[model samples]
Target chain A: MTVTAPPARGAITAGEPIRLTSVNKTYTTATGPLPVLQDIDLHIETGEFVSLVGPSGCGKSTLLKIIAGLIPFDNGTVHVGEQAPKEGRRDVGFMLQQSVLMPWLSVRENVTLPFAIAREKGSHIAPRVEELLELVGLSHSADMNSWELSGGMQQRVALARTLALDPRVLLMDEPFAALDEFKREHLGLEVTKMHEDMGKTSILVTHSIPEAVMMSDRIIALGARPGRVVGDIRVDLPRPRSAAMIATPEFQDISRQVREALAGEDGSIS
Target chain B: MTTIQTPPQPAVVRAETVPHTKPKDPLLSRTWVKVGLPLLVLALGVGAWEVASQTGLVNPITVPPASDTFAAMIDLSTKDYFWHAAWITLQETLLGFLIGSTLGLVLGALTGTFAVFRTALWPFIVAIQNTPRVALAPVFLTWFGFGMTSKVVMAAVICFFPVVINTVAGLSSVDANARMLFRTYGATTSQTFFRLTLPTAAPVTFAGIKTALTLALLGAIVGEFVGASEGLGVLVNEFNFQLEVAMGFAVVVYLAVIGLILYALIEWLERRLITWSN
Candidate 1:
């Protein structure tokens, strides 16, 4: 079946997009040498929202790590934008499963982390941090320490920190997986809105099928045990997605389609 | 003659009325378990000691009754002996605690950050920690002489190990993801250390300080016992020489008070500095 592509921002430029070609990674464990990813070929277009959905231990997180320039693949070349993945660019932001906010820092300080490294002579950072905090609806909590926040509020701070560099790509690894359903849905909507406003390339690693359907322009599925890409479904849903979308037949149908694609595929796209 | 019927409350109100609730106990109420019980046990022990002495089960000459010990404390307090002795020991303990904690914090951070430094210095620190500090009291006395210097050195030596051990543990216990997050931002090495590692380790380092405070007092007392003309330990020694058991016990009580005060001070400082950690 030829699936219709999602709404396009046009073809990504070769000079400024992340590309992974035939990447493979193996880790030495006590059991034996464990192979995690095999011949992984993937590309994330600029300003695109992509989601990776898979079973546990499918190396989905490992793929995101590789793209983040955190881990080296044993074989094949990985490229971030046009450059070889040495350190990638400080312009890329990472959000992990846990909202790793520094407890010692207040929300405002946490938001201004990247700029505090070596701010330019005349560049103003406080306004930018305040803007981001306001965007995340955490302006009232800017002076509060991270530990004082509820888990959802802390993740919001994490999101603010991720935007500190005004990054072109946001790599999120199950960022909201630990939260309860109500919190997850609420934050997910905010994240979707941010994606639209920021127009940054985003890759969300998640196990929730509804989350993938609700958020992404494209949902990439991988099979477990030496992970390989098995299905790529384009989500044709409209912008400004909401919690109410879950109840609509259109959303349910897409979720069902993705669910089948995940269940039927056995590590072979064909 | 007439039956009266009352309107029933709403389902929500009925649910609220029988809501499953847990009674919240105040900190003061909980203190009975933590503080009151221990105080009661101590009082019982003191009473038993007094009764044993009164009944002549244990000779009053060898182990003075509680009344005599209290009398000795009153006599010492009135004469300013307790104040003078405590002030001297407090100075030595404070110096040792400061020096020992500074060195430990610096060394622990360096060792935790650099693999080679950790490997090179770990063995020496271990060796020093293994050696009984009491056995080295005479050595410090000979080197620094029977004065404040020897007592301070002994206190520093005694306080050093806990600070090092706890600081290292605290530094190492920083969350792996937090470090990775810093790296992603291209944070400099020093930035990572200050922003993530130090704050993460503050609680553990504070724990080390509390331990060191008590140890420093003990070390100062032992050093004074080996050779000194002043301080509570010296007073205890002088009383022992004169066969004044009651006076020795009184000095012992004063030393305990000093140690308690020092530990409490460090604990308060720790709470103030790391309020965000919890």
Candidate 2:
């Protein structure tokens, strides 16, 4: 599936783009320096849902973290919206693989945490909180704690929180990978809905072929043993992709293409 | 309500780590059981003791009958000296626990967040914490003189380490995911500490405070045993010196009551602060 760049602007990004140049990273594990991500260069246009799909040992998560500036990469430059990663991280919204909701806080409180931390108070804040909760179909559970909700709903809370900052560039490190297949597919669509409706530029790191193919505008497959970009396949699927899109011939074909690319590699790809 | 998709199974994130809802409560394990069982046992024990004393198996002067001790307690309650002494001990424990806990919390937070601070102070803290607090009573007396200051200081020093240790552990052990989430929000170190770290640390910190309350009582009593003009500890000493064992037992009962009240208060606050935890 070859998707030409859409003409419409993303809600948050508009024309803001993410660029990485000659990035190399090696993490100091217990034994020695483990080379994680090799020298890589990539560019993501504004408002694109890009998926970095790879096997377990691949540096897919490392790449996402570097882009979010949660971890530093050696000998490279990463720019999000014309700013280096460290500074760019401040503007980018990040979602981790786990549903990082504070169990102590209510759904509304968890979502509006960015506002609370910033001491942002306005008549507008409450309404926005309501809007985000409603967007995730969690308005009824706004007053409930995350622990009272299911895993999928917890992930939704985390998604709501990522959107709370209203950032242009969203860096998601396998946000729905922890959920069961049913929820993963369901939330995969929900996330696509989020990206399409909000028009925020998003980068999703996942090992799931069908998930990457169904949700993202482009799938960047990474090869293992020092992860590097091997395939960058643009998805031609239309906007507002739904669960129904999963069964489409085009979606399955692209998914198979991503799978073939992944399975073709020497390393194990699940 | 309109719903997109309901997650079929409600397996909340880390549900195994926390008890979200109350577990099944048998009729035997209800809140009323918690409140009633102790009182029932106490009454039964006291009745047996009183009966034994009445039956001439127990002596009043050596180990006072439960009735005599109860009578002494009632009699002491009317006396100005008992109230005054109780108030002094209460004051010492309250002031010392408050001051020590605050200092401990602040220091623990600093050390917990920064490796340098932990490394710098850990050896000294561990060395001091290891020495029994009882042995330090003499040093406290020599340094601060035989006044209430010495006693209060002793109480503070004794209870300090538990709060420090618990607060540090609690703050440092805040779930890694929560900390990462805070960082991705671009929260400042201080913001993360205050918002995420502090609230997350609260249940454990309250646990420390609860532990410290008992230690505070012990410290205050130990200080009074060493030297003090007033306190429940002093009163107990006076009763023992005068061979009024029943009155001594009564003073101990009063101390137990004070400990219970303080512990209950802290437990209540802990429940309030981290409702999701239990």
Candidate 3:
């Protein structure tokens, strides 16, 4: 079955634009407080596809968590739409590196878990679930247990679950990093397609330069040792990106720029 | 051109091995070596026992022949009094297991979920659990009387600790990522407990339940030995008093069968409920 287009956004449920102003986060270590992110300022427009890329310990995942309201910052204000970020916000969806599907639950049940957590009745969300499963190309495996599916299938289930709430903003922390190269590229294209189709504001935390170029409208590079935004490059490439775009000059140019930013060559922004 | 790729196959890949070639198993690793050889040994042991009894190689009065024990078992199975005693013990075991496991589950959940309960109740739980519970059989008889009540109480006490410990471990050891997912979904505490925590805990808790079932039987028998008017334990004692050693062995066989059935029942239930767990 074909995936039906998601309903158009109303004013109240429109894509949530995110803004971070001088946000700082620190972890209390055995020795002292170690700052992970410092004076971070970022703004994402509604319906934009953005990627955060950096070296390890750069706190890109932490930044995604901050936007998703899964973690609190030590200082400064962060906003999703007009309101401050809050845990369990219905308008924000978070996907971790692992698919994190419950093994005991079937794929359909895992997708509908958000609704179950919210105490919503099953009948109202059944059709939406079917649409989501179809969107992720998992309609055939909906009745199968989460563990019975392959890693990519499990992540598809996770993606479907994140979309279960129809959240206006999607926060993905290297969601495809665990899969094989082919699976990663395939899922990357699927996510890019889904982002365009749904028109939901998306922020992906990835280490791969080509992935950021292939999937994102804007790529934000972060530096380590108290991670701060090092560079912000716009991808002016056309819509409906594909794997073949990776070999294109425009994609290569954008990826090279991101690599330079990650290497601290573009210290002008930091 | 944008081309959507078809989904990949499942991750598992089986290597193609050579056809019609069987790998030779080690001598002791074969099925007959593991199982049939043990049966042969058992048959030989039984034959030796029968020969020893017939030749008066050992004191027949104390050892009794294997045949005598088998005959006693068949004889006891035909008797109304023996069946009555067996029924009484079964009732006590079932009731005790149900009550103890239920209480343990509730208490374990409370202790595992709340630190206040853990702090307030753990020391006492540990103390009671560490004590020689079999010694309490006589005390239970005094407190709850010498009937099935005392036996059931004793069995319940014996069955409680393992279930409590396992439930706590299982509940606490849930996947942290899954917990984060639940938090992100705005799951209420109870919803998280029921959907994620409880199901995750089932396999471990079922292990405890299996252990407790055996202990429940032991507890009931110990309680019966301490003081009981009717039970398999009492029947064994009665046979011993009358010098019916074979009949005593028959009572032991009955206990073994009951234990096996209870354990198997629990295993079946575990498989049915927690199919996802290995």
Candidate 4:
């Protein structure tokens, strides 16, 4: 098994984007005590797309939640930039497994929700919302209710909503996991394109080995049950990857390596 | 920050993309299904009643069908008996509704806000709600006496529980993610209450109010049933005692009309007030 250096707890090195230090999480259950995550550490740099992958029951989602500040770890700390804030909310944006759009609001209103909440007296957000809608290719459905749109369209609205805050860090938990293969591939390309254009640091939690390989700058593979880092494969693949990249030998090689790492841990960890 | 603008083409795209299906016009659908059909049925029923009375198909003294009932209604209107009965009954119903709804809203909002209030008050509320107001009408009459005040109080009490139940349900119906999302923005508790909790609760509370309007009206009528000298309930009772079935039936029609009007009015208000909810 290959192991990467545990990310330093508090320090954000000159170029290091995010650091998780000895982060552990556990949940209390009626049956018994359950440990979701053990002391795990990893660092991701700016403009890096890191995918966390493991079997079901692994704490990939839990770790992403901790980073998003949606949940607190039982022990250890996480630093979004140099460190976590002392008070109030963090500016880190998040996308969940489900669309979670406000059913009552139109797609445009859903997209601009964070802005509406944070609007100044003279603040202008219409243009920003429009730009985001266009970017997500949802410009045409802005006026429609979220329920009126297809599931894929609704998720796109959710993505646009995440961008509404324009945060420095994006934490996504299986954002495209619900879509079909074609939609997933299409969205993966769009996400890659968006990441390249915006240069935002992102942590994606996914189950698909091919998806992790296709999208990430680095893939963090965790062992199942009491999820902990087992392998981190840096894809030195060149930029501007497209759907065509999945057909190439280089893409196949990275996919093979990540799969082997996943299978190896899958067999031994449980 | 750039000015917020909605993409305009979607409406057109949606218009083009929306599959042609049955009943595209919602207004037309509502008119045909909600209004026109009901009106047609009512008209036919009234016409049948008039025909039956004129043809002597039924005993005029017993059923007293349409013409005599219409004449009784006309007489009542001319003598201002209709207005007197309507005014008194309407007063009791409206006052009771307002008082009961206000108390319900306050209690509901408070209980929903505080766990202690919920624990203490919820059981009593449920008990009161399940207890039929009809059974308590005479009890209220005894306590407050057979007066307008008693009727008003009874009406209010009858209307109160549903409002409280609905308001609490609405307040607690807030989405968990939405709550967390607001918290993420550092929203104060009061901010969350007003911005998210209150608005979300509005539609549900309005539903309760819409339902309560009719119950309040029924309570006022029922209170009149127990004891009253000058309201519609009294008028109906007087006609029943004299066996003036047509006059009694006329008063019954008026009561139904009043109840229907209030029900429709509340429904309209609910829609108008919570238009943004949809």
Q: Compared with the true structure, what per-residue lDDT tens digits does model 2 show for residues B61-162? A: 678798789899999999999999999999999888988888988887776667777777867777877789778888888998877888888888888888
User: What is the TM-score ranking, best to worst?
Assistant: 2, 3, 4, 1
* Model 2 regions lying over 4 Å from their true place: A1-15, A28-32, A87-91, A118-121, A264-268, B1-25, B29-36, B268-278
> What is residue B181's positional error in candidate 2, in angstroms?
3.0
For model 1, how does the per-residue alpha-carbon lDDT over A132-157 read when each residue is reduced to its tens digit?
89988999999999889999999999
Model 4, CA-based lDDT: 0.78
| Clash pairs (backbone) in predicted model 4 | A125-B4, A126-B3, A126-B4, A126-B5, A127-B3, A127-B4, A127-B5, A140-B10
- Report the C-alpha lDDT of model 3 over B89-109, residue by residue, as the tens digit: 999998998899889889988
Of candidate 1 chain B, the 10-residue stretch with the lowest lDDT total is B7-16
**lDDT by residue for model 4 (B195-222), tens:** 7788788877777777677778888999
| Ranking of predictions according to lDDT | 3, 2, 1, 4
By DockQ rank, best first, the candidates go: 3, 2, 1, 4
Which residue pairs clash in candidate 3?
Answer: none
Cα error, candidate 2, residue A180 (Å): 2.5
TM-score of chain A of 1: 0.88
> What fraction of the correct interface contacts does each predicted structure contain?
0.45, 0.50, 0.61, 0.23
Reference-based TM-score, model 4: 0.85
Task: Write the residue-wise lDDT of candidate 3 on A124-186 in tens digits.
Answer: 589888988998999999999899889999899999999888888899989998999999999
Query: Where does model 4 sit among the CAPRI classes?
Result: incorrect
What does the lDDT read for residue A198 in candidate 2?
A: 68
